[model samples]
Target chain A: EPEVTQTPSHQVTQMGQEVILRCVPISNHLYFYWYRQILGQKVEFLVSFYNNEISEKSEIFDDQFSVERPDGSNFTLKIRSTKLEDSAMYFCARQGGTEAFFGQGTRLTVV
Target chain B: SQQGEEDPQALSIQEGENATMNCSYKTSINNLQWYRQNSGRGLVHLILIRSNEREKHSGRLRVTLDTSKKSSSLLITASRAADTASYFCATARTNAGKSTFGDGTTLTVKP
Candidate 1:
């Protein structure tokens, strides 16, 4: 089955550094989203993108975060000046008139 | 505030036993989806039931949604050791396709 794919399953970066997480959604998906889960916590919505622009975002998706559909197939989330609290598993998902399919996730660790 | 909340943070059962987890959401939704995740791993989509649908089944997974009650239940029948994972319920409030997820219930099936 087609699936959403994310790169760098594990990422370790230093505080105050920048990181970009990449995802390639299913070929025909029209909606894309970014979510995060802190260790042993709930999965929280960060942002949703459609029509090449962000449709909605949560408070957690503040000035430090940005999402882009840089191409037809690639969607990316960038965090500027990462903080220790930013450490979490970031998931990419896409919807094609069905349930959203999630990527393997990128575990971001900020030290 | 979180949109969905699931009960019984964790469950343990023997192989062949059925496991049921319940999720409650605070607002109207277009659909509710269930996902599974292994320890420190990515999420796997399990099943989705539209708000207008009462129940849906996929393999050993059964999902029931009650729009009036704003609650949903996921039942894994005759579960196996391989079924051990964290199960989460996510709600899509509109066709916009963004989803809000619950904390998830961790299931441990002993072989």
Candidate 2:
């Protein structure tokens, strides 16, 4: 079965540095999404993308966050300036319709 | 803010036993989905139940939805040691393209 894939399974960055998380969703999927989970917390939606634009975003996806489909296969989330609270497991997901598939996630750690 | 809340933050069951988890949501939803995640990995789609559908089953996994009460239940029968994971319930609200996830119930199936 084809699955979503993410790069840099784990990352450690300085508090004020910028970091970009990358994902390659399933080839035929049209809807892409980003979600995050603080340690021991519920998964929280960050943003959803479709038709080359953001469909919706959560409050957590504030000024520091931006998402782009820079290429046909790559969906990227960039955080302009990281913070300690930004450390979490970031997941990329794709939806064909009712069912969605998620990548293994990238664990971001801020120092 | 339209998130699902699952019951029993943790559960421990022996192999060959059945495990059941429940989730309640605060808003009307278009669909409800169940996902499983190992310790630090991405979420694996387990099953999806539409708002109009009352129940769904896949393999040994069974899911029931009561939209009137805005609640759902997932039952995993004849569990195995490998079934140990965190289970989450996600809700896609009506007319909302984004999904909200629950805190998740951690199940530990002992051998």
lDDT (0 to 1) per candidate: 0.92, 0.91
- Quick one: best DockQ, which candidate? 1
lDDT of 2 at B88: 96
Model 1, B3-106: lDDT tens digits are 78887799999999999999999999999999999999999999989999999999999999999999999999999999999999999988656888998999
**CA shift of B96, model 1, Å:** 3.4
Which candidate comes out best when scored by lDDT?
Answer: 1
Question: Candidate 2: misplaced stretches above 4 Å?
Answer: B94-96
Per-prediction CA RMSD (Å): 1.3, 1.5
Cα distance off (Å), candidate 2, residue B64: 0.4
Report residue A50 deviation for candidate 2 (angstroms): 1.3
Model 2 per-residue lDDT tens digits across residues A47-92: 9998889988998999999999987789999998899999999999
